[model samples]
Target: MNETHAIAGVPMRWVGPLRMSGNVASTETEVPLATYESPLWPSVRRGAKLSMMVENGISATLVDDRMTRSVLVKADDAHNAYLAALDVAAQLEELRAIVRKCSRFTELVALRHEITANLLFLRFEFTTGDASGHNMATLAADALLTHILQSVPGITYGSISGNYCTDKKATAINGILGRGKNVVTELLLPRDVVHRYLHTSAAAIAELNVNKNLIGTLLAGGIRSANAHYANMLLAFYLATGQDAANIVEGSQGVTVAEDRDGDLYFSCTLPNLIVGSVGNGKGLDFVEENLTRLGCRAEREPGENARRLAVIAAATVLCGELSLLAAQTNPGELMRAHVHLERKSTSTTVGGW
Candidate 1:
């Protein structure tokens, strides 16, 4: 028997010397091509990145700065991409500020505290987090609003509040307060060369939206509402790092976008209900566990728990998917070309099939 000490980089101390039945020890060849099999495959990894976006709402914009710093910047790559120009932390704080300012979400709907705001209706937030940031932001908004209401009596806080969550899908409001009626969503996409696939997919959705009233069916016309394209959510992230594929059910959100002036389209997605905590689940798995550690998201003293960092990661993922669909709809040839390019770049000996 050949002695082994580690599984997927999860090292286990070797207890004994190697023992082989054969007279001569077998020779093993180092396959450099196996590097392609690493969790960070160009395509699969990119998919993993987008899951972050699908899992979280953007600052209405913000990029995965950590990702850009690690993969592209560190490697000295020429170009890079991001959503909102502001740092993700700034965006998070901005949202926090919005909540802080509002003493209440609406009339007779006072918060646990009070605060203020400028944009009467800036964004219809998705509260992208574990369970719509229901408990998380609730605790926060409660404290902030409560403080302001008790202290700043002069502030004009409404009585109604907005936030939502649901153990099951029912009662359309999602159990959230301030569940506004004019909740418009866009399948956000980028106008750059690297992120234009969204046009094709967006077109497909648009066609459905345009004819929905007349034809009463979705894109391919299966069952309009059940048009689930969440396969990418699980496989992509699972193969990349340590995450429970099941959580994706609660964490995957699909939204649509329109209103492009230059004939270039944009798309955005939000999850708003992914309650993923780093320590509890997916702590053990061969390659999965190792992959998380390798990504440096997981580290000693709870380094993996950067909600902001995770949010940024999620935004990047949303951007990718939104762009992919849009591009596919606008020019399918681009996707074909991307596929061809990825295939060519892959190591033939290891990938084995065409």
Candidate 2:
């Protein structure tokens, strides 16, 4: 472990006994239908391995002892968290454009509403680097959005009620999930739910479980996209880091789903409310300061619209990472081959240009 390692475990190599476990908490308490898939894990492992090499190489350059090698690690939770963050980050530009239009209409109606909250509340997809991009995108959006609100027809009615430098609110629109983030595969138990769960806690509600006999029989089982896992993990990371967790309701989404060879589950996560800031009262919150440091996020990244950029970065992180995972499992040794191929292709393309 390096001096910068924040996660409890040192080396992220090997899950030891990678068997499917019971389940993560779900607010929907209906018939518990389980989903299945096997696309995300291998790619995530591949990325983590690459990061490990980087960290180890950096450490080895400084010290001669093999035992002294170390690097910041990406665990299973962190893996999912980072991927979801990336997906959310990529949607920043689209969200910005949409919010600008939405605010004009919502505010012009003269109703006692603020686009501030709604504008900041968003959904997008991207991938994360080795670490969770929760703080990264939140800070990115917080910085980027102020300009959007300021440039518009006076964003007098959005959720960003507070301000840092710009007139935008100190509280950003909350967010969840990233692109290509991986998670367990499973079907929602209820099988049919049209009502939008405004609150993030709705997933844990028993009525959504669908596993209660008659309803349970109607429940469907299959695989989900890693996006769902990324969405939930990002939410969990946000909650742990003192972010506005409620945004998960508005900004969260599960992007893709499909069945595995075993026909179990497939799912993905999508979220919009990536409300976060680089500097805030929460900086003093327990362990949040430390967590930020672990993720390598810094204050410079927090500014007008900076949050949006970081959000995009988070999504990109997940995208690249999930691709990495998918490549590894479907073809064993493919990960190594890809790295080599990418290098060779880059070289060939560069020489061809000359």
Candidate 3:
């Protein structure tokens, strides 16, 4: 079959010379976002502008980094399943050796398993250098599966992925155990800065966060997520940087925290599953390459440094947008007015029959 491909264009913009400092990266740089939501550019810019007003700006920390894949096997019986899990767990060094053969960058860092009714689910976690490690983790898992089936008695292959890895879906396991780069970004805005740039008081944004993000999400049965439109910023950043856009599924599963610290605003966004890489499947694209370079993610560094830098930037961007949106919601007409003005080219419209 002959196949033709076409380019789908997304409006791209550089939103900030955002000030960031952390263990991974300490640089003030403009980040690129490709999106159809024109309002996002200004909203995020507002947040970035606030970041600069603070003394330390945004402090992003890389808490953990790993990629995961799970493989399923069937045992002769429930007893056999338990035994097989024990046997595989004992072979950690051997499994690590097999992973090394798959790729120099792939290292088997940890293993976990669950057994039910003669079925075994083996979760393999890896440290993949400078890549998101989706394919790399799968390759390592495949090799380990082959070795396990041969050595461990009473077990046969079932399938490669058993959903325990929980790729591209909002699952509680991903948030609890984590997948990809885990980053926590924080900013402390003075009461005056909050009032000046956000046009909202610290107490107001903090109250809205509890009512809307925390309580509202809980009542709605959201799984391990509480935030306003984290997916929006993540999708835009992922697309601009040539990341696997679909990773935004698990990527958006993050939490936002706000506090009125004696009249100052203490805001944070914790992204436990930010799956991004500076070099990967989409990195070959000219635009993606350029964006990564401009974001300072393509520089030669230690084995996982580039990806870590990208993850922190992505988290900071999330915090910026999250902060801005929460602040806007503190006012009755601000959000709708801005949307109408930016998206519809008009600012005069009744909001909720006002």
Cα TM-score per model:
0.39, 0.29, 0.97
Scored by lDDT, model 3 comes in at: 0.91
Residues 1-354, model 3: lDDT tens digits: 989888799999998878989888888888899999988888888888778887678999999999999999998889999999999999999999999999989999999999999999999999999999999999999899999989999999999999999899999999999999999999999998888778888899889999999999999999999999899999999999988899999999999999999989999999999999888798998999999998888897998999999999999999999998999899988898888877885554222121
Best by TM-score: 3
What stretches of model 3 exceed 4 Å from their correct place? Answer: 345-354
Ranking by TM-score: 3, 1, 2
- Candidate 2 matches the true fold with a TM-score of 0.29
Runs in model 1 with CA error above 4 Å?
1-228, 294-296, 299-308, 332-354
Model 2, which residues run further than 4 Å from truth?
1-226, 254-272, 313-354
Alpha-carbon lDDT of model 1: 0.32
**Which residue pairs of candidate 3 clash?**
none
Give the candidate order by descending lDDT.
3, 1, 2
Worst 10 residues of 2 by lDDT: 60-69
Worst 10 residues of 1 by lDDT: 66-75
> Which 10 successive residues of model 3 have the least lDDT summed?
345-354
Query: What is candidate 1's CA lDDT for residue 327?
Result: 34
